[model samples]
Target: MFERGTPGADRIDALRGWVGDGGGLLMVGGYLSFTGFEGKAAYRNTALHEVLPVELLPEDDRVELPAGGRASAVGTGHPALGGVTGEWPPLLGYNRVRPRPGAEVLATLGGDPLVAVAGYGAGRSAVFTSDCSPHWAPAAFCEQWDGYARVFGGLVEWLSQ
Candidate 1:
């Protein structure tokens, strides 16, 4: 799992190598993520995107779901979602993603994919279109959702396998 503030290419290669070598990756989205707003990340061409199950299209709009905004439905029965009980907290923001062929949809918002999974070599990858911040993923960061820890833990566990 990686976070915002990770330096560019160095990190990209590290992550790319990890996935290519059969290690799991959990890429949580943010302003520093895939083609982030205003093309801030365009230079590095995020390595995770190459193997991501969905294609992250550049958009001018910035999504910001206010704290305590609304809860989106989880993909019932999903290994990462299972045992995650209660309403989800508003995710402050996310990068919009376009699902690619063979991608598995684990969750969505307004028909937009919120979470996706993909396989790369002997490893695999999981993506959360939103940041792992209280201001970004309000529910998950604030622990308002009972399944917060479980979901994250489950994702790591599953991806590792």
Candidate 2:
């Protein structure tokens, strides 16, 4: 289960139901992801928080990262990162995340966990700090790095597995 464009209590409830019903979710980051800027995500009541391996702090100036400036080591042991090899191209930006207890920290940025994975009942979830597009990750949009495809595709496969 994936939801985009809106974040609120209704959507959060919907996501919770989906996960509880055995559906996997990949909540992409954006103005609508998690508790977006200005607390627009407040209505969501953080319901999906339980399903995530990380906690989203109130969006502050902290979310900003220079475009194409840094890269983190991929989790080679994890299937979601298997095909993504080599020095990663820079990612323009990513969401700021606080890891939850008992969560698997897969990748990090400057001492912060950038990617995380967690299991919830019969399903699971993965949190990618950056937007899954060229704008936020120009390398992904240009295909200059095969990492984007492998990371996202591998995630879908892992969720199903």
Writing each residue's lDDT as its tens digit, candidate 2 over 4-123 gives 756545766788788767778776665566666676754235678778878777654136666454656556688756466556676666666788898777777656666677788887
lDDT of 1 by residue, 1-161 (tens): 35586745577677788898898887777776766767676623566677777887765324666643443645666676545655666666777778888878787754667778878877888887777666577645556666677778778887978
Clashes of 2: 5
TM-score of 1: 0.78
Give the clashing residue pairs of candidate 2, or none.
Answer: 8-44, 9-43, 9-44, 67-92, 95-129
* lDDT (0 to 1) per candidate: 0.70, 0.69
Which runs in model 1 stand beyond 4 Å of their true positions? 1-11, 43-46, 67-74, 139-141
Superposed by TM-score, candidate 1 places the C-alpha of residue 159 at a distance from the truth, in angstroms, of 0.8
**Which candidate should be chosen as best, given lDDT against the real structure?**
1
Off by over 4 Å in 2: 1-11, 139-142
How much lDDT does candidate 1 score?
A: 0.70
Residue 10 accuracy (lDDT) in model 2:
74
